[model samples]
Target chain A: MTATNSFFHPAFFYIALAMVLPFIRGRFYYWRWLLLVPSVVAIISVISMDHGTYMVIPWLGHDLILGRVDRLSIVFAHVFAIMSLIGFIYGFHLKEKAHHIAATLYVGGSFGCVFAGDYLTLFVFWELMSMASVFLVWLRRNPVSTRAGFRYFFFHAVGGLLLLAGLLYRYYAVGTFAFTAVDPSNAQFYDYLIMAGFCVNTATIPLHAWLSDAYPEATVAGAVFMCAFTTKTAVYVLARGFSGFYILAVMGTLTAIYGVLYASIENNARRILSYHIISQVGYMVAGIGIGTLMTVNGAVAHAYAHILYKGLLFMGAGCLLYAAGTANLDKLGGLVGRIPLVMIGYMVGAVSISGMPFFNGFISKTMTIAGAAHAHYTWLAIGLEVAAVGTFLSVGIKLPYFAFWSKPIYKGELRPIPINMYIAMGIASGLCILQGVYPNVLYNLLPYPAEAMKYHPYTAWHLVQSFMLLSFTGLGFYFMRTVIAPHPGRNLDFDVLYRLIVNTFAFIICKPLAWMDNIWTNVYRIFGMRGLLGLGTGTKWFDLKGIDLVVDGTAYTVGDIGGVSAKAQTGRLQDYLAWTVIVALCVFAIVWWL
Target chain B: MRNWLGDWLEKTRIKHAKIWMGVFITIMAALVIFNLFIRPHHVEFGYDAYCGFWAVFGLGVCLLMVFVMKKIVQPFLAGPEDSYDSNE
Candidate 1:
C-alpha cells in the first residue's frame, strides 16, 4: 500500500477539524452534525490500519514514526476515539466554540501520543496533550479554575521537560530514539528519569496533588474529557515500558490505599472521583509491575474498563453540577427523585468502581489481585483488598448516599439539564454493564493472547467472596455514616507541600525582595547620590583652581621672559650682539660642566 | 400514572432504605454460609479460603479506616475549604 493510504495518523483529522469548527455559524446545528466528524473519521481510520509502522518522516537527522499500529497502541487508541465521541455527546449543548476546539485538540493529542513509535514523537504529543488540556480548565472562566489551570499546566510542563531530558540523554547513550521497554534490572539514569516523568503523569504519590487540585475546578463538560485521558495514557506507557519494575508495584499499592483514604473524607463529588482515578490507575500500574501475561492483560483490560465507568461517573457528577450548581456533598442531598436517571447512572459507575459482583470493576479488579497473589506478593495483594473495602465504603456508599438519598440540604431551584447529557450517560452506563456481564468483550482486545489468562471472574468462590466483602463494607458504612458524613471543609493532601513551596516562592518574591529593594533605594538616596554630588563639587573646584593655576603660572612666566627679551632686542644691534654672545657662553659653560 | 409512580417512590424512599439494609445483611449471611461449603481453586493463601474471613476483614478495615480518618486524620488535615483559595 502507498504511504499516504497506510500511514494516516488519527490526530490530524481532529486537529484539522478543530480549526474549522470556529467558522461554522449556528451553534446547535453545527455541533449536532459536525462535532462527531473527527472522532468518527478517526475510528474508521483506526479500524482500517494493518499492524506495522507507518508515517515515517525524517526529523532532525532521525526517523520519526508517527503511526505504530500494534495491538497495544490500537487498544488505547480505540478507547480514546470512543471516549472523544462520548465527550462530544455530553458537551453538545455548549455554544462556546473555544470549548469544542480545546476538547478536540486534547483528544487529538492523546491519540497522537498513543500511536507514536519514537520517543521524539511521543514527547512532542505528550506536551501537546498538556498544553491542550489546560484550556479545558481555563475555559470555565472562574478565578478558581483560572488559577487551577495554571497549576495544572505548570506541573505537566515540568513532567514534559523531564521526559524530554530523559529522551535526549537516552539518545546520546544508546544512539537511538526508539520508544521501547526499559529493563529495570539494567536501566541507567536516563531510564529512571523517563520513568519519573511517566510517574508524575500517572499521578503517583507526592506527585499526585495536581489531579484532585485541578479536576474539580474544571468546567462541567471539560472534566468528562479530562477524566478519560492523561493518566490512562501514562498507564499505557508504563505498561509498555516499565513492566516488571518492582518500585512501581510498591508505589502503586500505596497510591491505591492513599487515594481511597482521601476519597473517604473528601466532600466535593468530582474531587472524590478524581482521587478514585488515582486509586484505579494504581491497579493498572501494579499489574504492569507484576509483569506476567495475565497481570499485564489485567492492567490493559482495567484501563479499558476504567475509561468507560470513570467517564460515566464524571458525566453523572457533571449532571449534578449542571443541575444543582454545586458538587459539594454537604450542600447536596435528596436528588434521587428529582433526577432518577442520573442517580441510576451514577450508581452503575459507583458499583463498577467498588468492584461489586456483576460489574466491570469485579472483572478487572479481581484479576490484578489474583495476579499479585499468584506472583507471591502477599502483602501487596492484601493492601489492595483493604483498599477495595475502603473503596466501597467511601465512593460506592457514602458519596451517593449523601448526594442523592440523604436529608435535603439544598433548598434552591435545580436547573434543567440538557437532553444530550442524558443520552451520553445512558450510553456509558450501558457499556459498563455490558462489559461487566461479558468479560470476553473486553478481554479479546488485550495485548496478550486470550488463552494465556487462566483466570475466571465468575467462579462461585470469587462471587461469594466479593459479595461478602462489599456487603460488610456497606454495613460498616451504615454503622458509621455520621462519622463519614460530608463536612464543609478540605482535607490536607500532598497539595499541602505544593502550596508550601508555592507560598515560599511568593514570599521570597513579594516580601523579602520588596524589602531589599526598599533598603537599596534608601541607601542609594543617602550615600550614592550624596557622594556623587560631593565628587562633582570637588571636581569643579579642582578644574577651576588646580589645572588653571598651572596653565596661568606657565603663561605668566613666559610673558615675563618675553618682556625681558623684548626689551633687550629693541635698543640696538650692539646690545643684541652682546646678549647673543652671553647666551652662547652660558650654553658652552653648561655643556662643559655636563 | 406518572404522578402515582412519583408519589409511590417518594413514600417508599425511607422503606427502601430499611429494606435495603435488611437485604444486605441477609446477603452477607448467605455468603458467609456459602464459604463454608465451597472450596477455592487456589489455596496458596490459607486465610482467604476461611469462612467469613473476607466479611470480617472488610468490615474491620472499613470501620477502622473511618474511625481513624474522622477522629485522628481529619482533625490534623481538615481546614476551611477556602484555605488554599486565600493563597491563590
Candidate 2:
C-alpha cells in the first residue's frame, strides 16, 4: 500500500477512540470491548504493513511520514500495541473516563513515535506522549503525584525542546528531517543535542531520577502503563538514531549499575521496580551503543521482553497497592497466604525479570550480555553481569520477600482485588513464559535475522551459569536478609539535585524578580502616577489662566474699538463729513511735512 | 479455593520450606560441581569460562551492594518518607 492509498495510521484509531470516550456516559459497560482498539490496531499494523512508508504528507515543506512500517518500527509497534491492550485490561475497572482518554492518547502517542518516519513526526508524537502521560500521574490527585506530575511534565518539556532545537538545527544544516542513524565521526553539535534529549527520556543517570521519583507516585494502573512506554521508546529512538556512539556504552554501564545500587536500598515496592526499569534500560542502551548487528538485535529483543515482564512487575505492584492500600515494604508482609495468586503472579514476573531459566528476560538479557562480551568489551560485560546479580537481589528477592514473605507489619484491613487486574497479570505472565520457552516467538521479530544472531539461551552451560548466579545471589540475600531489610525512609537520588536546582532557581531568580516587580509597581503607582496627575493639573491651570486671559483681553479690546466706532457714527451725514475732513487735514499736514 | 490453597501453603511453609531451601542450595552446589566436570565454550572473554566465576561474582556483588547500600549509603541518603513535603 502506498502512503495515500492506505487507511488511517493505527495511531488514529486510538486518537479517535480517546475523543469519543468522554461522550459515552453513565457506567462504562462498553469499555471492555472498546479496550480492544489497540489489539485491532496491532492486527492492522501487521496486515497493512508492506515495509515502506505509509501516510506521508507534505507538512511545512517536509514529507512527514506518519507510518514508517519497516522491520525496526514494526517490532516496536507490535509490542506497543500489545502493551496498550494489556494496560487497558489492567485498568478496566476504572470508572474515570479521563483515565481511559489519557491512556489512549498516551498509547496512541507511543505508536505514533514508533511509526514516525521523520523527526518532525516523531517530535509531535513524542510531545503528545509526554503530555498525555502526565495526566496519569496527576490523576492520582494527591499532593505528591501532582507535584511529581509537574516535574515530569517540566522535564519532558525540556527534553522536547532539546529535540525540537536539534531537529531544526539539523534541518537547517543538512536540509533534511529524515530520522536516520547519526554518523558520529562527522556529526554536528545538533546530533549530540538530539542524543541528549533521548538520554533524558532513556532515564540515563542524572536524567533518570524522574522515573523512580514519579512512577511510584502514579496511580496503580497508571504506573503499569508508565513503566512500559517512556524508557522503551527512548531505547527505540537511541537504537534508530544514536547507535554506535561510544559515550552511550560508558553511560549505559554506569546507569545499569547505578539503578541497581539504588533499587537495593529503596523501601517502596513500586520505587524498586521503577529503579529496575532504569537498570534494565541501561542494558538496552549499552546494546545499542555497541552497534554490532547482534547487539542491536539484542537491544530490540530486550526492549520487547522488558516491556512484557516489566509491565507484569508493575501489574504485580499495582495489585499490592490495590489490595493493601500501600506498596511500602516496611508495612507489608505475610501476604503469601492471603493473596497467594497475586504472590504467584508477582513471583513469575520477578523471576522473569531476574532472567531465570525459561523466562523472557533469560533470553533477551543474555543476548545483550553475550553481544557485549562477543564485542570484546570485557569489563562492560562483567559490569552488566554484576548488575544482573543486583537485579535478582533487589527485584527478585528483596521486593517480593518483604512484600509477601516477611513478617507482617501491616495490621490494616486488606481490600478485595479486582478480577480484571488478575486477568491482565495472568496474560502478561503467560506471555513471559511463552517467550522464554519459545525464544523464536521473540527472535523472529528482531530487526536482524534470527539465524545470523548466532546466539542461544537454552544451552546447558547458559542454563547452568544463570542458575548458579541466581541461586548464589539468593543465598547471599538469605544470609544478608537483616541487613537488606526495608525501613520507613526515602533514599536521596538525582531528584535532590533537580529539586535543589529548581528551588534555587525560584529563590535566586524568581524571588529577586518578584521583589523588583514590587518595587516597579510601587514606583509606577506612587511617583509616576502622582507626577502625571500633577502635570495634568498644571496643564489645565495654564490653559485656563494664561491662554484664556490672552484671548479674553483681545476680545475686550475689540469690543472697546467697536464701541468707539459706534459713537463716531451717532449722526449719519454730519459724523461722516467730520470724519472725512479730519482725515483730509491729517493727510495734507503729513504731505507738507514730508 | 482460597482456604484450600492457603492451608496447603501454610503446611508447606511450616514443614517443607527449609527443605526446599536446602534442596535449592544443593542443586546450586551440584551445578557448580557439574560445571567443573564439563568444559564450557571459551569465548574472547575467558574469566567467565571458569567453573564457578558467575556464582562467586553474583554472590559477592549481591553481598557487597547490600552491605554498602545499607550501612553506608542509606544513612546519608535516607530520610523521612515525607521529607520532600511542602509543609516541611
Candidate 3:
C-alpha cells in the first residue's frame, strides 16, 4: 500500500475542473452532467487510492507532500467528495458560472487541505478554502451579504495570518514544516497560535462569531456547500495536531452550550442551523481534546455522519429560501401544506441532527459521549449531555414545529422547489438512515475501525435512553412553546467586539491621520507655493523651471501617497478587506513559489 | 409524488392533528415504560442507573435552556434584525 511520491493527486480533479469549466459555456447548460464529472472522479480517486504519499517535492531544503493518503485523510476525503457531488446536483439549476466555479474551487481547496502532508501545503490550501468560500457569501448579491462577505473574509485573513506565523515559527524552532500531531504536555507558544488559528475555523466559542455572522447571509446552495467544509476541516486539523489539549476539551463543551444558547433565540432558520454547526462541531472538538483512541474515532465518525446530515439540513433550509424566498422562522409557517416533501426531507435532517434513536446523529454523537463517560471526564460528559438536550430542542423540535407544523399557514405564492434539490436531499437522507440502522457502513471508514466496532449505538438501553431524552425534550417544548417561539431579532456574539474594534480603529487611527495628512498637504500647497509666488524672484522662475519640476513634483506625489494611505480608510469594511486577500495571496504565492 | 404527499398532508394530516397528538403522548408513555425495563448494563454515573434519569435530564435541561436563553439572555442579547448591517 506504499508508493513513491508521484501520481495523480485527488485535488487535481477539482482544480482541473475549475480551470476547464469556464470554457465549458453553452454546452454546460445542455450537458449539465459535465460539472458532476469531477466529483465522480474525485470520489473514485479517493476511494480507490491506497494509503501512501504522492507528489513530494524538495523545496527550500524541505519536502512538500501534496498527497498524504491515510485512513484519517481518506475518511474526510470520502465525505468531502460525496458532499461535493450532492452540492453540485443541488445547485444545478443556477446558470451563474461564478457559483459553479467558486464551488468547484472551494471543493478543490478542501481536497487540498485533506491530503496536505505539510504545513506549507495545508496553509496554502487553507487560504484557498477561505478565499473561495467568501464568494459563496458575496454571490448572494445584497448589501447585507456583501457586508457579511467582508467580515467573513476579514476574520479568515486574520486566521490565515495566525496559521502562517505559527507554521513559520514552528519551522524555525523545530527546523521542519512537517505537519504532525503535537504532544500536548510539550506544546509550545507556536502550537497555541496554530491551535488558535485552527480554532477560528472550528467556530470555537468566541472565535465562532464569524460563522453565524456570515453563513445566514450566504446564497442558498452556497450555504449547503459551506456547511460541509470549513468547521469540519478545522476539526480534521485539530484531531490531527492538537488532540490532547485540555483547553480545547473545556472550551469545546462550552462552545457546544454556547452555540445552542444562541440557536434557541435565533429567528433565521439558516442562522439557527449556523449556530448548531458550532454546537455539533463542539462534540467533535471535545472528542479530539479528550484524545482517547475511542474519542478520536468518535470524532471522525461523527464528522463523517455530520457532513451527510448537516448537508441535508442545509439543503432543506436552502429549499425553503429558494421556494419561500425567506428562511426566517418568524416569516414562515405551515410550509408542510405546500412543500410537504421539503418538510419530510427537512425532518429527516432535523431528527438526524437531534440524534433521534434511528438516525445518523444517534450513532455518531453517542460514540463521543460514551467515550467521554468511559474516560471518567464526568463534567465534560454531563455538559455534552445537557447540550444534546438543547440540540434536540432547537434543531429537532423547535425548528420543525415552527417552520412546518405551526399555525397561520403560509398562504403566500410559493415558488416551486426544483426536483434536483429534493433528489440531493433524498440521497443524503437515505445515507443518514442507512448509516443509523447499519452503523458498519460508517464504522468501517473510521480511523480505527476495530476500536469503533466495539462501540455499539443501538443497544436496548441506549435506544431507550435516547428516546426518553429526545421524546421528553419534545414534551418540554410543548409546555414551553409560547416562551420559546421564534421572534424577529438578532442576538449579538463576538462579532460585536470585532465591529467595535474595527470602527474604533477607523475613528481613532485613520480619521486623524487622514485629517493631518490633508492639513499638511494643503499647508504645503498654500504656504510654500504662495511664498514662492510672492517672492516673485529668480527663485520662482528657477523653482518652476527645473528644481520644482523634479523635486517639488516628487514631494507632492509622495505626500499624496501618504494621504492616500491614510484616506484609504474610507470607513468601508470592504476597503480594509479588498487588498488584504490579494496581498495575502501574493505573499503566500511568492513564498509557496520559493 | 410531491403533489400527492403535499395534498395528503394539508388535508388528511390536519384532520387527524389531535389524533396525532394523542399518539405522541402514547409514544412518550411507552418510552418511559421501556426505560424501566431496559436499564443500562453498567451505570457510568450512579444516577443514570435510575429508571427515568434521562427523561428528567432531557425535560429539565430543555426547559432550562428555553427559559434561560429566550427569557433571560435573549431580552438582553437581541436587537434589530438588521443590527449588523449598520455599514450598509
Candidate 4:
C-alpha cells in the first residue's frame, strides 16, 4: 500500500507550523508571512479532501479517526482554516513569536477536534485548545490579564475534567469511545456531562461567564482568534452530538437574551463583543436543540457565516486597541476621524451581525429563527427576535456610535495601524459580503444542503421584515440612548458566582483539612511513633532470634559435610584409581551376565 | 482617498448629522409603508400578519432590554470596574 492524500488533514498543517515557528528567530519581520502559510494550506487541504475518513490510527481496539471528512466537519474546518488565516494576517504586525505559535496551536486544536471521530482524540485536542488559548490571554503580560488567564484556565480545567469524566464513563458503559451523535432520548448522565463540558466552551449561560471575563482581557490580536474558535467549536460538537437536547434549546434562548442585555450595559467595547458572541452562539445552540433538518442546517450555516464576520469585528476592535490604547467605550468617541477605514470595516461587521439584508448574518440567523417559528416554537422564536433587536441596539448601533461618532471626540495620540491589519479585516469583510451576496456559497456547505437550498432568505417579506426590524431597533436606540449609554463600571456576571463557589470551597475544604492535620500531628507525636517503634523492635527480634537459628544450623551442617569430604580427599590418586577399577569391573560383570 | 473620507466623516458628517438622522427616519417610515403592501410568506404567531408588528416588536424589545438591564439589573450587577482586582 502507498500513502495517499490522507496526510492532508488541516490540523497537521497548523501544528507543524507551530512547531517550526520558534526556529525562525530574528528574521521574523520579513518571515512573518510564514504565519499565513499553514492556514492557506489548510484551506486548500479542507477543500480537496473527499467525504470519507482520511487519517485513521488503530488504538487499543478502536479506530481513532483523525479526519472524519463529511459535510459537517468539512463546513466547520473550512471556516476555521479561513478564520485562522485571517487571524494571522490581522496579527501580522506583532513581533511576538509566542502569540503566533499559541494562536496556531489553538487553531490546530480546534481542527483536531472538528475531525476527531472518537472521544479520546477529541478530549486531547480540546485540552490543547484550552491551554493554548490561556497563553493567548496571558501573552498580554499584565496583572489583570494574568488573573484573567488563570481564571480562564481554571474554568476550562473544570470543563476538561467534566469532558474526561463523561467520556470515560461512557466508554466503560458502552464499550466504545466513538464521538458519534447521541440519541437525545437515550442520553445518559455522561452525555449531559459531555454537553456541560461543551456548554462551558459554547458560552452557554451560567457556564458562560469565563468568555466575557477573559476575551476582553486578552491581547488585541489574541481576542480576535479567541472569539472565532472557543465557542463555535463547542457549537459544532453540540450540533453533532446533542442535537434536540431540550436543555440546550432553553439555555440557548436565555443566553441569547442574557448576552445582549449584558452587552447593552457593558462599558468595554471588547467585552460588549464578547457578550454578543454569547448571543450569536445562542442562536446556533437554539437551532441545534430545535433538531429539525432546517434548524440544524441553519445552525451549521450560521457558524460558517459567523466566523468570518465575527473575526472582522474582533479585528476592528483589536485595531482600536492596538492604535488608540483603549477599548473602553467611555474613553472612545469620534474615532471615525482618526481611523475611518476601521470604522468602515467594523460597520460591515456590525451590519452583518445585526442581520441587515444582504449581509451574512441575515442569510443564517433568520433561518434559525424562522425554522423555530415554523416548527411551532413560538416562544423560542419570539425570544430569538428580541435578542435580534438587542443585538442591533448594542453592537450595530451602540458600540460603533460610541467608539466612532459619539460626542467629545477623544484627543488621545493615535498610532498608525499596521497595513496588514487593514488588509486582513478587508479580507474577512469581503468574505462576509461574498457569502451574503451569494448565499449558496455558505448554504451548499451545510449539513442539510437540500433544506438549506430550499430555504429562501430573499423573500419579499423577509426583506421587509429585516429592514423594518433593524431600522426600528435603530430608532429604539435613539430613544433610549441616555438610558443605555455605557457607564464606567463592571457589571457582575456568573464570574462573581464562580468566585463565590471557589471561595466557599476553599473555606469549606481548607479549614476542616487544617483542623484534621493539627489533630493528626498531636496524635502522632504522643503515641503513634512509640507504637510504631515497638512494632519495629518486635519484628527485628523475631527476624534475628527465630528465623536466623534455622539458617545457622543449615550452614553448620554444610560446613561439617565439607570437612568430611576434605578428609576423604587427603590421598586422592590411589583412591581414585581403586574406585575406577571397581566401577569398571562391576560394569564388565553386568555385561557378561546380560 | 482614506484621508478625504476621514475628513468628511470628521467635518462634513457631523455638520450634516441631522440630515443623516432624517435620512434614517425616512428609511424607517418607508419600511412601515411598504409593510402595508407586502404580505408575510407565512404568519407563525399573533399579530405577525399585521403591518408594523415587527416595527413595534423591535422598538418594544429594545426598550424593554434597556429598561430591564440598565435600569433594573445594572444597579444590582454594577460595581467599581476593578472589583475583581481589588478582591484579588
Predicted model with the maximum TM-score: 3
Candidate 3 lDDT tens digits, A443-503: 9999999999898888899888998899889999999999998999888888877766655
Instruction: Give per-residue CA lDDT, model 4, range A1-594, as digits (tens).
Output: 134564488888889988998877564387688888898899888888787776779864568888787899999999998898889988888888899899999999999999998887898799889989999998998877876776687688778878877876787688777898999889999998999999999989899988998999999999999999989899999988999987888899999999998999999999999999999999999999999999999889888888888899988998889888989999989889889999999999999999998899999999999999988999999999999999999889999999999887889999899898999989999998998899999998999898889999999999999999999988888998888778999988887777666666555655555565456445545665665878656655654564444444333333322222323322442253346446534543453354
Query: Clash pairs of candidate 1?
Result: none
All candidates: TM-score? 0.86, 0.87, 0.90, 0.89
Superior by DockQ: candidate 2 or candidate 4: 4
How should the candidates be ordered by lDDT, best one leading?
Answer: 4, 3, 2, 1
Which candidate has the highest DockQ of all?
3
The Cα local distance difference test for each model comes to: 0.82, 0.82, 0.85, 0.85
- List the DockQ of the predictions in order: 0.42, 0.41, 0.60, 0.45
Minimum summed lDDT over a 10-residue window in model 3 chain A is located at A560-569
Which run of 10 residues does model 1 chain A get worst, by summed lDDT? A560-569
Evaluated on the second chain alone, the candidates' TM-scores are 0.77, 0.82, 0.87, 0.88
**Candidate 4 — what's its lDDT?**
0.85
